[model samples]
Target: MVDRCSLEKEYILSPELKFKSEIQQLNNLPKAKKEFPRLSEVPSQVLQQTIKQLHKGWEYFQKRGFGAPRFKKFGQFKSLLFPQFQENPVTNLHVKLPKIGAIPINLHRPIPTGFMVKQVRILRKADKWYASISLQCDVSVPDPMPHGHPIGVDVGLEKFLATSDGVLVKPPKFFKQLQSKLKLLQRRLSRKKKRSKNYEKQRLQVARLHHKIDNTRKDFHYKQAHALCDAGDMVFMEDLDYRITAKGMFGKQMLDAAFGQFRSIVKYVCWKRGKFFSTVDAKGTSQQCPECGEEVKKDLSVRIHDCPHCKYKTDRDVAAGQNIRNRGIKLISTVGQMGKETACADELPGAGVIQSRQVSQPRQGKTRKPKK
Candidate 1:
C-alpha cells in the first residue's frame, strides 16, 4: 500500500496495483483466498485484523514525522489477535479459538470478577506458545494523591538504583552472566548447515537463552520497583532519556541496565499501590549540592560527591537522589500549595525563600471585571 502511494505520480504504473479502501480490501479477501488457498484456512476476522493493523501503522506514519510503514519478514510478525468473542473462550485447562479447537494451557491466575475478557492474542516465544488475554472493566479509579515521605531515585550502570532514603541496589548483569554460553551456542549453530535439523535445534537453544535473560532482568526490575513503593509514599526520579546513553561507549551496560523499562515498571507499581510518582528536571542533578544550593562540578569518573562549601560528602549517586528529592518536595509545595495544606513548609531547604514568594503572589481567585 505504501509503495503504491509513493509511486502514484509515476508515468508508467501497474494496472493491478490499486490502493483500495478498507471495505474494498475486505471484499477482495475472497479473490485473494482463491489465489492463496492458505488464506482461507484462518478466520476472516483475524485476516481483517491484520489488514487493519497495517493501515494503523500507515496512519501513524502519516501523523508522526518519521518511521514509514514497511514489510515484516517471515517469522517477524509473531502474534495473532482475536478482537471479539461471542462467548467465553478461556477455561481452567483449555482456550478455544475460532478455527482451531481447544488447546490445553496453564492458567497463570483466574480472571478477576466483574471483568469481561475483551480480546485474546496468541504469541510464540522460543519453542513455547502463549496467549495474552485482555480484560475490561467499567470502573473509574481516582489517581493517587501526593502524601507522606518523598523518595528520590537515581538509576545508573554503577548501581541499579539509589534512593534518597540511603538504600542502594547493585545491578545484576543478566546478559553478561550467560554471554559466554550464548556465544558457544551461536558458534556451534554457525558450523551447522542453515535450515538443517541441527541448525534449527541450535537456533532454538540461542533464543531460549535470550528469553531466559530477558525474564530474569524483568523480574529484577519489578522486585526493585515494589521495594521503592514500600519505602516511600511519594517517589521521584530524574527525567533523563536513557536512549541517548545507550549509543555511548558503555552502550551494552546501559542496555543491560534497562533503566527505561525499570522506570516504567516503578511508575506502574506506584500507581497500583496508591503511591505518588513524579519526575524532576535532570539538569545538573549530580553537580548541585543537596545540603546547599551551590554547584560542585565533577566528571563522570568522580564517584564520590564532596561539597567544599557545605562540607557535605556522600556517594555521588546518593547525593543526586537527595537533590531529586529536594526538587520534588519544592515542586509539590509550589504546585499543590503544600505550605498551607501540608506540613512540608518546615522541611524545604529554602523554606524562607518559598514563604516569601508565597506571600508576594496573590491567590488565584475569580477574575476582576475589565475597566469600561
Candidate 2:
C-alpha cells in the first residue's frame, strides 16, 4: 500500500514555487532559448547535464508528436515518471541535499502500520524539508461495511460538513488567524531583492509559519475522521470538491481545514478495515428533509433545520447526515436484490464484499486529479 501524507507547507510550496518559478523561467527563456537555439539537436546527456538541480527543475521537451511540460528532478521526478519503486526512508529523516544537510522532521502522526519506508523526498518548500515516506504494507484490502448503520455527510460552503448523526465538522479557520502575520511576512518578502540572501531567509520563515497552520489543520482532520469511523461501520458523504472553483474562489479556511484530505483518509481507512464508504448527491442533501423526504427552506445563515410539512427540526448538518445514511443503504444493494429487503447488502461483482458501499463517482469530478 502506497500512502501519501502531504505535509501542508510542502504542498503549498509545490504549487507556489511552481508559479514563481514559471515567472522567473519566462523572464530567462528568451536568452536561454536563443543560446540553446537548436535544443532539438542537443544530445540527451547534454540535455540532462545542462539541467542543475534536475529534480527541482521542470521543463518540456519535444521533437516527435508528444510534447509536455514536465518535472525533471532525480528522486521526486523519478517517482512521478516511473511506477514500480521502493526505498527505505530515513528514520531520523535527515539525509543529505545540495545545500541543506539532513534536516529535522517533526513526524507527529503515526506511519502506516507494518510497512517499510521505500523512499524519502527532501524538498525545499518556502523553508522546511518534509520527508514523504512511501510505505509498502503487507495487509490486503478490507471487506465492506455491514448494512446495520449507514452514514451520509453533507458538505457546504457555510458549514464544513453535516453528518447523518446530526453532527457537524466545522472547517477550521486556520489561515484566517495567521493571515495578518502572513501578510506582513509576504510584504517583507516583496521588499527584499529577488533571489537575495535576505529574501531566501524570509521565504523560509514564511514557509515555516505556513507549515504550522497546516499541521494544526491536519491534526484536526485526523481526529474528525477517526471519530467519524467509530460512529458506524460504513461512512457516507459526498466526494466534495472543496477546492476553489469558477463560481468563486474558495476561502483560505476551506484549504486550511482540508476536508477533501479527511474524506480520502476516511475512504482508505474504511477500505482497510472492511467498512462501507460511499457518497451520494450533494446538491439537495441539505434542502431535502431527511425525516419527511420533502424540500425545505434553508439559507446559508441557518444552522438548525426546521421542516414545515413534516414538522421536522434538527441541526442542518445532522439532517443531511441522516439523508446520506438512507441514500447509502439504497446504494449498497445491487440490482438482482431489487425489492428484496433480505438481499439488501448483496455486493456487486467488482464491489468486493456484499457490504461494499462504494458509489460510482460522477463524471464531473473525474477531470480534476485529487491532491492532498
Candidate 3:
C-alpha cells in the first residue's frame, strides 16, 4: 500500500489530493478486494490503519523534514499494529487479535483497573514474539515538583560522566566486554552455508548476544539517569551534536559511549519526575577556565585543567561541569528576570557555584627562528 501510494503520488503532483484519492479508493472494500485478494482476509480497520500510517509518514516528511518513507522488505516489516483493540472479553494473560486468535501474554506486571487499553502492537524479534500494549488513564492527583540539589553533568568517553559536585561515573562497556565472543560467533556463522539450519541457528545466537548487550547498556543508562533525576532538582548538561562527533577519529568510541541515549534518557526521566532539565552551549565548556573565564587551550591528552591566568587547578571534566553549571545558572537567572520571577543560584539550596577570579596574562615564550 505504501509503495503504491508513493508511486501514485509521484504522478498526482498534489500530495493532498493524492492522499484523499487514496483514502477513498481504500475505503471501497468491493474494489479493493477485487484488486488485492489478500485484502479480503485482513480486517478493514487494519488495512485503513496501514494507509493512515503511510499518509502520516508522508506528512511528517513534508512538514517536519523527516526522511522520505521507503519500501520495507519482508523481514523489515516485523510489526503489526492494531490502533483500536476490541474489549468485549478481557483476559489476564491473553490478547485477541483480528486474524490471529488470543495469544498468550506473559504479564510481568498487572495493569491498573481504571486504565483502558488504547492500542496493541505485536512485534517479532529473532524467534520471540512480543506484544506492546498502550494504556490510557485519567489523573486526579498531580505529581509534585522535584526538590533537590541542582548539579551540572559532563559526559565523555574517558569518565562516562562527571558532575559539578566532583563525582565521576564510569560506564560499563558492554559491547567491548563481549567483542571477542561476538567476533567468534560471527566468524563461525560466516563459515556456515547460507540458508542452512546451522546458519540460521548461528545467526540467532549472534542476534541474541547483540540484544543482550543493547539491553545491558540501556539498563545502565536508565539507572544512571534515574539516579541523577532523583538526586538533583535542576540538571544541566552540554547540548552536543552526536552526529558530528561520531564522524571524528574516535567515532567507534563515541558511538560505543552512547552519549545520545544517555541524554535522551536523562531528559525524559527529568520530565517524568518534574525536575528542571536544560542544556547549555557546549562550545567553550571544556576549554574555558571556570574560575576566571579564561580560555585555556589544551589537547585531548590534558586530563587536568591548569589555568595559567588564575592559577586554578582541577580535573578537566569537573571544571567543564562547573562551567556548565555556571552557564545554566546564568541562563535561568536571565530568563527568570525577564519574566519578573527572580531566580538565583542561591534559590537552588545545594547547587554548586564557582567563585570568580581576576584574569591574569600568561608569560609569553620567546620565538625561535628556524635553523636553515
lDDT of each: 0.81, 0.58, 0.75
Indicate the residue-level lDDT of 120 in model 3.
Answer: 82
Best by TM-score: 1
Top-scoring candidate (lDDT): 1
User: How well is each residue in 39-136 modelled by candidate 1, as lDDT tens digits?
Assistant: 99999999999999887877788788678887776667889999999988999999999999899999999989898889999998988888999999
Where is the poorest 10-residue window by lDDT in model 3?
358-367
Model 2 ranges with Cα > 4 A deviation: 1-120, 137-139, 244-250, 336-372
lDDT of 3 by residue, 1-372 (tens): 245554344443554554464567566756868877987898777777777787788788889885888988556777778888667223687878888788788877877788888888778776678888788888764543323456688999888888776767776678898999999999999999988889989999998898888788888888888777655677899998898999999887887788998899988888888787889999989999988888999889999999999899999998898888778766766644334333446544344442333111111221111122
Clashes of each: 0, 10, 0
Cα TM-score per model: 0.85, 0.62, 0.79
Arranged by lDDT with the best first, the candidates are 1, 3, 2
Worst 10 residues of 2 by lDDT: 361-370
Q: In terms of TM-score, how similar is model 1 to the real structure? A: 0.85
Model 2, 103-134: lDDT tens digits are 56676666656776654443454444455555
